[model samples]
Target: MALLGIIRRWHLRDQIPIREIARRLDISRNTVRRYLRSETTEPSYAERRSVSGLDKYSVQLSGWLKAETTKPRKQRRNLKQIHEDLKELGYAGSYDRVAAFARQWKAGQTEWVNSASKRTH
Candidate 1:
């Protein structure tokens, strides 16, 4: 949105040419033209559908995370332990991938809990 505003200001208000705007912004002239021509305030992009190696093990990982949440914090297995367990189960992805998935899962869980609490209140 900010970029769109800047592009518009440079072209309409400051009277900067499209070629200059493209050069200053380090974008293609065609892109600058498209941005100027579009009626929307921001450019829209199609959603990407990229697959990850962790997709196959997501259900199992989620189960482990949910089960761990029921245990005492000191007794719960950390992400490293979960990664090793996944390795035993034939997950070939890196520990970083598992960690990222866990972070995203926990975020979603937090959002769900917050929304549920709001509904009850």
Candidate 2:
């Protein structure tokens, strides 16, 4: 967005050359042109990237997470513990992979709860 703003200010306000804008912004001339012509602040992105690294054990991981939600926070399994358990079950991914998926799942759960509460109230 900031880059787009810079391109717009330079092109529209100062009548700067696209090549000059590209050079100043360290971007391609085509990129400068596209940003100038774009109507929105954000770039459009594809939704729902196909994730497969944790797909093999996602169900088991979800089950563990759901079960943990009923337990006290102190007693709940941490990411490292969960990663270790998945490893024992033949998961060949890194700890970072497990942690990242766990975070995404937890965030989705939070949003679900928030929307449910909003609808009920």
Candidate 3:
């Protein structure tokens, strides 16, 4: 819209060349020429960053998560337990982060689902 206004003002009022207008506006000559010659409007540009975590322990996390799926005594460890274990193993993360990841992983376990859903409600 702003580009169209600039092009219209230059072509209809100032009589400037497309290249000159482009240079003065610090936009591309092709963009100015497109406005002067073509019918399509410029599209808006937006970049979307991915949602994946940088510190994903997915592989190790998965194995740990699988162990957690068993009954409390049978389960190798819980998140708080995992957090402590990870700390001992040189993992640099907050208990909250470890807990949060565990919660997400546990979401897939049917046995944990009822308890998690009940807590959420």
Best by lDDT: 1
lDDT of 1 by residue, 12-117 (tens): 9999999999999999999999989999876677999799999999999999999999999999999999999999999999999999999999999999999999
- Compared with the true structure, what per-residue lDDT tens digits does model 3 show for residues 4-104? 87796897799998778988889898888777777666667798855544165657777877766555775466577877777776777678877776676
Give the clash count for model 1: 0
Q: What is the TM-score of each candidate against the true structure?
A: 0.71, 0.64, 0.40
- Looking at model 3, the pairs that clash are none
Off by over 4 Å in 1: 1-3, 9-42
Off by over 4 Å in 2: 1-51
Error of 1 at 119 (Å): 0.8
Q: lDDT tens string, model 2, 6-55?
A: 78888889999999988987889998888877788866668977867689
Which of candidates 2 and 3 is the stronger one according to lDDT?
A: 2
Per-model tally of clashing residue pairs: 0, 0, 0
Residue pairs in candidate 2 whose N, alpha carbon or C atoms collide under 3 angstroms: none
Between candidates 1 and 2, name the one with more favorable lDDT.
1
